[model samples]
Target: MKKFIMKKKKILIVLMLALLLASGCSTNDTKNNINKLEAENRLLQEKIKNLEKELNSYKKESKEKITIYYIKSTQNDFVLIPEVITIEPEPNMLKAALEKLIQDKRNPFPKDTRVIDVTVKDFIAYPNFSREITKLSVGSRGEELAVASIANTLIKFPGVEKVQILVEGQTVETLAGHVDTSKPLGRNETLISIE
Candidate 1:
């Protein structure tokens, strides 16, 4: 009977040891899982912070606004002339606005005589005013008057840093006998000076 009790005690001790080892192994697995999850969480937080910074920069850039100006001539019955003018809108919007202005019949200039090949790049207005020359009455002082009138008028637009007149896609010697059409024009507030 004593032998039987001794053998039973040995079996119980072995079972307890096995149970303890299993519990220890489970605790180690849980700890490893917790460490992996913590690392992943930290990485995600870093990514979120970087994304927030980029978003803030974009917002700041978006908040900046641009301004532009438009100029028109009184002698030509308030016709819009090509001159150094600042335009407030973006390039696409400026193109659309100019096109709208050209199409408006209420505009003073003759429909066919109007020049619409103007482009605004980097706040500089490139006015292809040479096309209007073909429509002008030949040998008439009207051509010179018209060039000056146009240049003087366009300088009124907002944000126009400068104006470059292109004749048939090339720079010309002069628009009339007075204003030098070779160089790009700066904003001239007074129309009389353009002559």
Candidate 2:
């Protein structure tokens, strides 16, 4: 489409130049017209270059993808499943990733699981969850899977190296009494199928 428009513009410019040549105007007037057309052509070329550059930049940004972790059962037990998704760059990217992680209802976590708050400092993410997350009855395996899911998801963010889970602003020992939650948790890639 751009090519077609450019062709039409070129033909119009040619017609304009032909008109100027045939008008039999004074030499000074013809020179001014040529200069004016040249300036307009330059502007058009610059505009097209800027548009192409913006288009390439948009394509680059759209191709970017982010990984989110969800709990999925393999053979023996539940594990963290990595899912690739695209999100616009934002200040609250950690919170957005956690929100995506909560969308999978089939995971070990309860359906009402949600991220209440998130903060990052020194490469550590403090992600607080709703009380609904800790009330699941899926046993120790479920609890561990839940923790791994949250930890793995947070670490996918740029600056988050570990995650500290909180429930209503207090760090509990465990979400379901399976894994230790008194400290910040790092990514547990070994728990996943890795395929």
Most TM-score-accurate candidate: 2
Tell me the whole-model lDDT of each prediction, alpha carbons only.
Answer: 0.56, 0.82
Please give the range of 10 consecutive residues that has the lowest summed lDDT in model 1.
Answer: 63-72
lDDT of 2 by residue, 1-195 (tens): 999999999999999998887775677788999999999999999999999999989977775467877777677767777888887665677877787777767566677878888999899899988998788677877777778888888887788899999888889888777789999998887787675
lDDT by residue (tens digit), candidate 1, 73-122:
46553322432433344544444444444444433334565454777677
lDDT of 2: 0.82
Return the TM-score for each candidate structure: 0.37, 0.64
Model 1 has a clash total of 17
Candidate 2 lowest-lDDT run of ten: 59-68
Question: Number of backbone collisions per candidate, in order?
Answer: 17, 0
| Candidate 2: count of backbone clashes, pairs at least 3 residues apart or interchain | 0
